[model samples]
Every structure is written in structure tokens, then in C-alpha cells.
Target: MPKTQPTIRDVAAAAGVAVSTVSKYINGTQRFSGSVEAKLKAAIDALGYRSNPLARSMITGKTRTIGLAILDIRNPHFTNIVKGANRVALQHDYTLLLVDTEESQERERPLIEALAQRVDGMIISSRMPDDAVQWLLELSKPVVLFGRSQQFPIASVGTDGHLAASMLARHLLNLGHRRIAYLGFAKSRWNDERRRGIADCLQKAGLQLDVHDAEAPSAIAGERACSAILLGSSQPDAVICYNDLIALGFMKEARELGFRLPQDLSVVGFDNVSYAEYASPALTTVDLQSEKMGELAMTKLIAALNGSHDDEYAMLEPRLVVRESTMRRPDTSQPAGVTEMTPKTAGGRRRTGGQGA
Candidate 1:
């Protein structure tokens, strides 16, 4: 068996034509006279030739692969999104090259530049800074962002973070809780979206949100932020977290501070990540349709790759998921340590705290 793939030059030589002519013929963007086309076809067949994805990309400037830059692959939240992208990418015979920024734009920049040569397009999770984004845009490659915001102009697929936040706020307020706080991630589009959502929900209910930034969305960050919030002069009747990990961290810290769930405080988280249910009290959260968002993003990207220059953006809706972590305000007369909290609508109606209906 031949060890090495045949090169374009070899094809050109065999066909008795210049390499550029052969490349143009192969890419199908150039018109060739009848005799030249026939000769090239004959040479291709005789060489048992297949286009080298790498070499062809070098000549035609298209890798046919998409680069995916994720903040953290270890987090189930990001992985869930990737699963969706993978499904769609496979359907189009496209490969996804995943790179972790680890929440650092500086580290992410060089990685993106390195991968740029290997991919025709990029789907970014927004670890890049403004300068980097501007640079990427200037590079003139097709880019689709996962998180949406007015600040960025690239086509995007994002969850309805604002609505999700509002829903969570309203859920707690309807449970007869007067004091509620939001523990959210700071300095990101998703963070801002969720915060705006919370504000919207609070406004509709004639309530105000006590928003606190966790500095990080990681479990450790959640723990610290929760501790600080609980230690404050006034403890909130309920807490809403940026994501499930933060919620779980808050719960753990709240327990340490003798703040029992659904009794001393109700808690809700966003993202509804896998670990949300496995936590001690299980987290009440907003399902951001994360996986579905990923799927939709790739679908749009594929359409663009197939030569659609039309502008498209998608915002997946979110819904509240009632689990054990949220419920009606505790009976003041009763001592803490009760389990199982029921969910309430933003309008003060009781509902099951099971899976999302």
C-alpha cells in the first residue's frame, strides 16, 4: 500500500498542467477549457486520487473544520453544550477541535491563533477579551458566539438568561419570601443576562433584587460568596445562584452557618447542570436549554459554511425547575431541619417541586 498520500503537485504533473490549474479544478471554483478538464479527470482516475484535507486546505484555504473555544471542558455545563455541537457537527462530517481557555483570555488568544490555520470557522464561548474579539473579527473568518449580548456583533446562540433570572426571582418571591439575594457570576455575557432577568422578575413582582457577584462561577467561588452573604448583618430569606455549582456551594456553606434549606433559606441556581440534583438538598434552578443552544449554534454554523451569508441569531428559552432546594417560607414557630420544599409561581401559587413540568 502507498504510505503517503499523493500531492497536488503530483496530480498536476500527471495531468500535464500547472499546479494552480489543478487546484482550481479540484476546488470547483474555476472554469477550465474542455480538453484541460478531460485530461485532469483522466489523471485523477489513473492516480486513484483523493484530495488531502490538509494539503487541499493549504491550497484552497478552507479546513472544513470548526474550532470550539470553551471556558472549561471539565465542567459538565460546558460539556453538555459540546454534546449538542458534536451531534450536529458529525451530521455535517465536520470535526470540532475543542480548546480550553480556563477562563483566561490571555491564554486563549494564542491557542485560537494557532488553531486558526487548521479551521475554517470558530465557535467561541467568550473567553476572549474585547481586543481579541476585534482581532478575530478582523481576521475575517466566520465566527459564531455561544453567549449573546449587545456588546458583541458576531452571530450568537444564547439562553434567555434574563428571563431565567426573572423567573427564579419571581419563584422565590411568590413563596412569600420578602428578602432574596442573587449570587451570580460577574464579567460575562451570561452573567449580565441572568442578572438582568432577575431584575426583570423582581420588578414585575414589585420586589428588588439583592445581587452579589461570586467573582467566579466555580464551586469554590460559590462557597466563598455564599459564606460572605450569609455572614452579612441581614440574611436573605432565599438565594439564587449563577449556576448549580454555585448553588451547591452556597448550600454547603449555608449548612455550616446553621442555615437550613427551605427553612432558614430557600436557594435556586441556574444552568441546571448534572450535579444540581445530586447535591445535598438538590438545587432549584432555571434550565437554560444549554445543550439545545449548542445544537442550534452548530446548525446555524453549518448553514453558514454551506454558503449562506444571511445573518442569524437564536435565543433559547428558559424554565424554572423546582427541586428540593426551594419552597414556601418556613413556619417561624417551627424549628429548622425540615426537608422537601415546594415551588411557587411568581404569582403566589403552590406547585410540585419535582422535575420541571
Candidate 2:
């Protein structure tokens, strides 16, 4: 007769525990006492027991894996989020497959469809449309949103973009900045969420939204948009950027225009990325808790897999990080490139006030 493979049942028998106890331990469903946990581990090792999670999932109509759909992998903010999600997923023995839509929602749909076939669930961190999310819901698979929340019953885990934007705008407004411009790539749906946040603040204060366009979500794009704003007839006293890259780009261009940082134009950036602090003037930004958002999404996804949570959403708070990049409207200011700046610090390391510098 062929030898039988050591299964979870054998491990449970050896450990003197119910099969359900072993299952809970393996799937991260419930915690066990220290001694019991140790004995269970020993029993599994002694019996050479191995869990075929994939096979078991197959039997149960699950894949035991989750898919992550994101936009612009090059952005540091997104990168941090991926790291956080990966970390949390590993703890629960879950695997993550990432998909970058190249900032294109059209590509997002097909990619999500392809991935949904292989993974048990998905987390979308892109500019996906409501209709697309509804479509995913109809597919009968667990889906979660990373940044934006859907109107339907799918899960959402992210920072409060609107509140963050309002905080940034309010900071500038409090600094006596009357002419403020918001620069971003508004073509994408995700950007719209951020825009609405800033718009809410501006409207509340009886101020109009001065919007500008960017080529992309990079430093180069930020430079172009900021340059345009500088050349425009109505020069803004401050500019609220979509992200750190755009804000850095604007600062670079502002310098070329013989403008001094914070003296002539105070700039505020979102997503408090690493480079925010190392720039010539340092950058003031909103900390979106990207990593925490990722961690939360992973936790939620894992919980869903273990039947812990139904379809619930999680939202994290965003805090503002004030740094050297912004200060009271400069009393004495000049156009960009009027004065040369000193070389950056050693190792070219930018100071991270604490989190995203």
C-alpha cells in the first residue's frame, strides 16, 4: 500500500487538539496560548506535516492569493504602500501579485480581470472608475480599494485625501496667501479625488480653485506646470501640488525664475515622500500614511480570507508635515535664480522630519 501523506489531521492528532484548532492556527484565524502553540508547532514538525493551502483553497473554491492593482510604480508613495502590504500579507502566509496600469484606467480593467482569475481577491490602488468596481463586484470576488472609496459595498482602505488637501490649503490660507494655485494631473479619476479635497477647502474659505495641469506625476511634470503658473498673468503667492515630485519640480523652476523658496512663493506638496525634505528649501506636505494604508488593506484582505470581516472599509487620517520649504510669506523675495544656493548636505541625504522627509 502507498504511504499516506502527513496531513493537518495527523498534526492535530499528535498535538491532542481538534482539527479546527489546527486550521485556525494555520489560517491565522485565532490565537493560541504560548504552550499550546509551541506544542502544535512541535507536532507538525515531528509528523513532517505540510499544508497544501493552494489545494485546500481549490477544494474550497479559493486561490489563497490576493492581487494588487496600482498606478505609477515609479512613485515612492506607491512603493511604500506596496512594501507595507507585502509585509502584512507575509505574516498571514498570503501572496501578493502587483499590477501597474501605467496610470491608465483602460489597462486597469483587463488587468484586474486577468488577475482575478488567478487570485482569491484584489486590491485596486489606481484611478479605477465606479462602473469598473461594480463590474468586479458582479464577478463575485472580494475587492478592495486602496485610495478611493466606491459607492457600492466593496471594501476601501486609504487616507482621507479630502481632509489632507483641505489641511494643506488651510495652512497656506492661514499664512496670508491670497493667490494660491493647485497643480496636478486632473485627467485621472484618482486625481479628481484629491482635487475635490482641495476644492472643498477653497470653497469653504470663499476662495476659488486655481487649477493647473501636469504632464505626468513626476518632477518634470511639476516643473512644467509650475513654470506655466509663474508665467501666467495672475501669479500665485502659493501653489498646492498634487504630490512631492510636482512640488519639487515647481520649486526647481521657481529657482530658475530667480525666485527664492518660501520668500516669493510658498509651495505645499501632498504624499510627504522621502525627497520632500532634501530639496533646496525642503518641502511642506501632507503625510498620507501610505505604508499604514497598505498594511491595513493587507490586514483586511487577510481577514476576509479567514472569514473575519465581511465587506468593510477602513480610512486612515492624514497629517501635515511642516518643513523649511514653506514659511510665512517671504517679506523679502526675488524672482528665481536671483541668488545661488549652497550645495546639499553630505550623502545628499535629505532630512526626514520623522516619517516621509
Model 2, poorest ten-residue lDDT window? 335-344
- Each candidate structure's TM-score, on Cα atoms with residue i matched to residue i, is 0.79, 0.77
Q: Backbone clashes in each candidate structure, one number apiece?
A: 2, 8
Candidate 1 per-residue C-alpha lDDT over 68-169 given as tens digits, one digit per residue, 9 for 90 to 100: 888888778889889999899998878898888888856877887777767878887875434446676665777788765355567788876666776677
List ranges where model 2 is wrong by over 4 Å: 1-60, 148-150, 203-206, 330-357
Query: Tens digit of lDDT per residue, candidate 2, span 241-277?
Result: 8889889988998999888888888998888887777
The CA lDDT at 271 in model 1 is 81
Q: Give the clash total for candidate 1.
A: 2
| Best of the candidates, lDDT | 2
Q: Model 1: residues >4 Å from true position, as ranges?
A: 1-51, 127-132, 149-152, 330-357
Top candidate by TM-score: 1
